[model samples]
Structure formats: structure tokens, C-alpha cells
Target: MPHLTIVANITAKADKVELVKNELLKLVQPSLKDAGCINYVLHQDNVNPTLFMFYENWQTRELWQEHMNTSHVKALNEATEGAIEHVSLQEMTGIE
Candidate 1:
């Protein structure tokens, strides 16, 4: 199987890093159990306090796209509306 890796770099504004971390942590399970998701993990940058990373794995690209359109995704998008500086996402594939 060709596993999917989603790399997300998130920046927090207004010193809201902790707040966003807490919010995002609360959001982990919903995404974890979503249809094609194999794993969903979140981490904070050591040097850059305001930066966060989310590494998500999925069974397929199509299912990952579906996960992005779910209601929980919408809620997350809304949660970070004013508190986030920027978010960048990159999709990659695992290699043997």
C-alpha cells in the first residue's frame, strides 16, 4: 500500500500557540478515527514556540481529501480563523 503523509506547518499569532495546541489536541481523536486515517499526530516546535506540526497518515489520497471536507475539519478551520498566522500543508508518500 502507498501510505499518505500530510505535513502541516502551523504558525500562531497573538501568542496563541498554547491555546491552539490545546484546541488541536482536543481535535486529534476525531481525525484519527475518520474513515481512511491511519494516524494523526501533533507536535510543537522546540525553538519556535509559536510553531506547530501535524503529521497525518492516511490509507489513500482520496480518503484524505474526504477527511478534509468533514464537519470537524470545518470546525478546526473556524477555530484558527483569527488566531493563526499561517498554515502550510504538503502531501507526501512513503517509500520502502
Candidate 2:
């Protein structure tokens, strides 16, 4: 089966960009350690500091779903409540 790819975009409230970014950064290390995680990279938009994106690859869709339910993810949700403007997530399979 092809690996699962996730593209997640996060936009922070104008006043809460740093807070949201910090919270998002906390997810990287832990997410990289998760089972079946191939790569978990975070990127910030050069033109728009308020925009952040995560490019992730996992061994399978199920493992990626498991990662989403982790404590750290829950903590991120709690910590950034009302601080985020919008979030968009997409799951894809590489076309190899």
C-alpha cells in the first residue's frame, strides 16, 4: 500500500500567532516518535507569518489517525482554543 500523506494548514488569530506556533511546535518531536511516522515537518508561510503548515507522511492511514488522538494533540487543542482562525487538513496517497 502507498504511504499516507497529510497536509495540514493552520491559521492563527492575528494576536495569537506566537502562541499558536509554540503549541504547534510542541507536536513535532512527539509526533515524530509516534509509531509508523515516516516524517513530520512544520513550515511557516514566508509571506504570511500567521499561516503554518505541516507536511507529514505515515506508514498507514490508521497510524496517522492514531496520532491525531494522542494526548499532545489534545493538549494543542486545549492550549490554542480561540487562538486559531482556521484549520484545513488533507489526506493523500502518493501517485507512485
- Among these predictions, the greatest lDDT belongs to 2
Cα lDDT tens digits, model 2, 7-92, are: 99999999999999999999999999999999999999999999999999999999999999999999999999999999999999
Residue-level lDDT of model 1, residues 1-96, one tens digit each, is 788999999899857877788778877989998999999999989888889899999999999999999888888878877899998999999778
- RMSD (CA, angstroms), candidate 1: 1.1
Query: Measured by TM-score, how close is model 2 to the native structure?
Result: 0.98
Compared to the true structure, candidate 1 yields what TM-score? 0.92
Show the colliding residue pairs in model 2: none
In order, the Cα lDDT scores of the candidates are 0.89, 0.97
lDDT score of residue 40 within candidate 1 = 96
**TM-score for each predicted model, relative to the true structure:** 0.92, 0.98
Backbone clash tally for model 1? 0
- Whole-model lDDT, model 1: 0.89
Clashes of each: 0, 0
